[model samples]
Target: MHNQQQRIIASAAQREAAQAARLKIRAGFDRSTAGLAAGMTQVNMISVAKDWAYDFLLYAQRNPQSCPILDVLEQQHYHSILAADADIRTDFPRYRVWQHGEMVDEITDATAIYTAHPELVTFLIGCSFSFETALQDAGIPIRHIEDQHNVPMYLSNIACRPAGRISGNMVVSMRPIAAERISEAVQITAKMPSVHGAPIHIGHPESLGITAIDRPDFGDASRIAADEIPVFWACGVTPQAAIMQSKIPFAISHAPGHMLITDIPDRAWMN
Candidate 1:
């Protein structure tokens, strides 16, 4: 039962506070801590001294989807990473530490690493949440978001390219749909490639070796009614799982569902 510790936090005020902090930073301030106390749990904490943005980029290019690099945050700089106003360490609820392809420990903060070497690079990748609105817009519903829980993600038999030291089978999140609407659902979701694109497979759980729909490799499972057929989509969790397997020398990623909120609007990906 302890495969992964799931943290429950109030995300309502969290989002509102994060948005306010972003706005204040935009208006010119030393930093924005408006959402400092935001109840975010299990955000991946990682930091390393010495310039390593190039290494992160190279790793990303090799493993694009798994590590879809959204924003990279540097110690004192803000741009491709996190904004200068934010602190990389202690932002999330928990942190998983990976060194030399091995998990050393999970902690609450990595400030000590930054204290010694402030030139570390932080990267944020695209999360499956980026496409949830689209799914809702197309008349398809999301169960986890509705339940205010982490979307159920599974590590399937599918394999991703070995980008440097990262490589593993694809991970997918499942959504239940009426058996009749499966085709329409796939067509509608396929348009958004930037956000894990579309459904990788239809209703065959065995084909993907899913085993049980209710028991997932990560996150709590959602209810699937008898009238509903389980639909699966390529999940950002795929990369995280891969990185865990690879045990990169030094790596960091968002804890599942605790994504880095970005300024990129929903419509930005429409084109």
Candidate 2:
């Protein structure tokens, strides 16, 4: 049965996540006392559906920045992947659930949504923070990191290539890179594709068809120094744009800024 196969896939994905969690624990973030991970992957527990697991995987595949999936774990209907000890519907500070291409609710949890929709899929896309390492490595001082505000993200006029029921313009997050080190930042990021890879466009927003640099489509707008030009990148939110355009029956994503932090290290960039 397709459902049975999906269960098997979910089981496999959970085990894979458990293994990564063990490795992550060995690397640092402990799981034993996370308060809820107990008896999750290591024992008799419900395994999330593979469709959900695959959904997260596909989202990660489609959107690398905003939806970066550090790990995925599976339970009867819950998948965390690398986050075996984590809770899918509640770990993030906020969740945005969409119906018919429009936001319906901004909730702190999605347990009810899953309960009602037997086929709803969950995804954990990679965040820009993953690539922030490469930027920092290149000596590009990320201003938002110091300010503690959510990194600024904007919906651009540029369009992302379509992928399976999804397609939309790119959503770019901005970082005020100094004038002197801009090239170094680009050169360093070009090497890491798994983490959004490199800047989609830089220098001027209007050139990219973005007329209001101060008015971002999403996230807060920051001060661009007189000397610094706003640098833009293809954001993970690109896929959300796709979903919006396609107007899928239903969808869900992390609230902008409240990212699912993975234990994966930034230095592992070379990987």
Candidate 3:
């Protein structure tokens, strides 16, 4: 009975923390949410016009590793089932507006976009950030969080399965894990398939067409210690790559590293 009571209290605390983080983000706290709301689930968001919604849905299905669908809001709706009373438009700390496949503006609030295009269908995809707490608990270090930097993501030569008009190379986020802990890191993350599963590649960045380790296509780069090996995982940012490559007419996505803090706890998705 005591343990059960403790579990309930911890669950409530996680929900409260998630809500508080969203409130601050709604109030214009523009920054990366990498280490924020520690034990809560975080998600990557992308909204596309209703016309392209089916195509994007197919794309996500074909590329589950990089685009695991969590909660999808139908056209004209902004609330997500993952978080009660949460408005998708203003909950994220930062947003990206894409026009003709180019990022035109980076804004703190995305209310205007949804207001202008009420026909947009929003998708909240699983993010790797949801599993960082588990990794930390296992004594695995997340260098980006340790250095106060956003996790480094790179565009890879990996081509996702094409669906309708959506097709693009995969984008991967990299973390340096100590050589000895590589197997343990893999085991911990593999249990949370909804949040990217496990490392797709380890050691050789060149195999993925990523020649530059110190430079990244998205987010800030972290240094890899000599004793560590660079580990890569399929990233939720894959949708943005699709938008850019496919030249989608209009789209809105959470800025890389700035995720939506859902009311759900990270353990909810653990296997």
User: In candidate 3, what are the lDDT values of residues 1-271, reduced to their tens digit?
Assistant: 1112323223777888988999999988989999999988899999999999999999999999999999889988999878887899999999999998999999998888799998899999999997889999999989999999899999999999989998999999999999999999999999988889999999999999999899999999999999999999999999999999999999999999999998877877777
Candidate 1 lDDT by residue in tens digits, 37-145:
2322111223433344554467566655445555556664324332233545544444456666566775545456445445666655555565566667767777776
Best by TM-score: 3
Ranking by lDDT: 3, 1, 2
Q: Model 1 clash pairs?
A: 42-93, 42-94, 70-124, 72-80, 72-81, 73-81, 73-82, 100-249, 101-247, 158-169
- For all candidates, the clash counts are 10, 23, 0
Stretches of candidate 1 exceeding 4 Å from the true structure: 1-17, 20-59, 73-85, 116-120
Q: What TM-scores do the predictions have?
A: 0.72, 0.72, 0.96
Per-model lDDT: 0.57, 0.56, 0.92
Candidates arranged by TM-score, highest first: 3, 2, 1
- Determine the backbone clash count of candidate 3: 0
Off by over 4 Å in 2: 1-77
Relative to the unseen true structure, what is the C-alpha lDDT of residue 74 in candidate 3, on a scale of 0 to 100?
95
